[model samples]
Target: MMNLCYNMGADLWNLLRTGGSEMKLLICVLNDTDKLDELMIKLAEAGVKGATIINSTGMGRTLYNHQESALMNSLRALLDPDRDENKTIFTVVDEAQEKAFHKVMNEVVGDLARPDSGIIFTIPVDSVTGLSK
Candidate 1:
């Protein structure tokens, strides 16, 4: 069974609906910057109409930025010199398309089980507005 996370305080009755099915918010974090274009293509082919992508940095990278010390800097560099940036993609998907969405994500992003590949999850959306059909 897929792990479903509920957004607390979202009115159960106010869900976004299209074609008689509720909508879910699909969030994906990808570590590999080079794969973003391919991922977007897959999402479009899977019927995702729109999505938002934001540049993001992990907690370790944030700490590395704030701390200033020769030894610490050297250690951080050795540990993760690149401090690669990540991308967080968000989109609203119909409940009926959940399985297909997962399939496309897995196909483009590869096995999420492998560390640092990225994470894909869904949250039940109570309501949404300004979405174009």
Candidate 2:
């Protein structure tokens, strides 16, 4: 189990490190796929530089809403390591240009105050190795 866990972690790290200092993960759960493309364009305008995407689904039959299903689908894709939705865009941004990154996310994503805001999140990376542009 330990070795399995290590290998899994390594694989995930390898996947993420492919981008280097420009490593920023963007998980946006939205209702409209078109909005995603629009958001991508906006990100470009905001200087996001580059991104990767992964599709996802929710597992729970019932929740506050279907958002969980979307997230669950993403988790499934992550596990399979072969499938992903173009929806979960993995954005890579350099630390020197995070301002542009946030600008992109806020400009494109819908209102978050609403109960169903379709959240967008980011995960910063400390160091990257064994990967390239």
For this target, which candidate reaches the highest lDDT against the unseen true structure?
Answer: 1
lDDT of 1 at 5: 29
lDDT of 1 by residue, 1-133 (tens): 1223244324443433355577789888889878889878887888888889999888876785777777876787799755558999898888656777778878887899998888888998767777765
Candidate 2 CA-lDDT value: 0.57
Over the stretch 1-133, how does candidate 2's per-residue lDDT look in tens digits?
9999988887677556553354555556654455677877777776666667666543322242355576876676578543222255565456544666556556666455565435667686544553235
Model 2's TM-score against the true structure: 0.50
lDDT for every model? 0.77, 0.57
RMSD of each: 7.8, 11.3
Which regions of candidate 2 fall more than 4 Å away from where they truly are?
A: 1-24, 59-86, 95-97, 129-133
Instruction: State the TM-score for model 1.
Output: 0.71
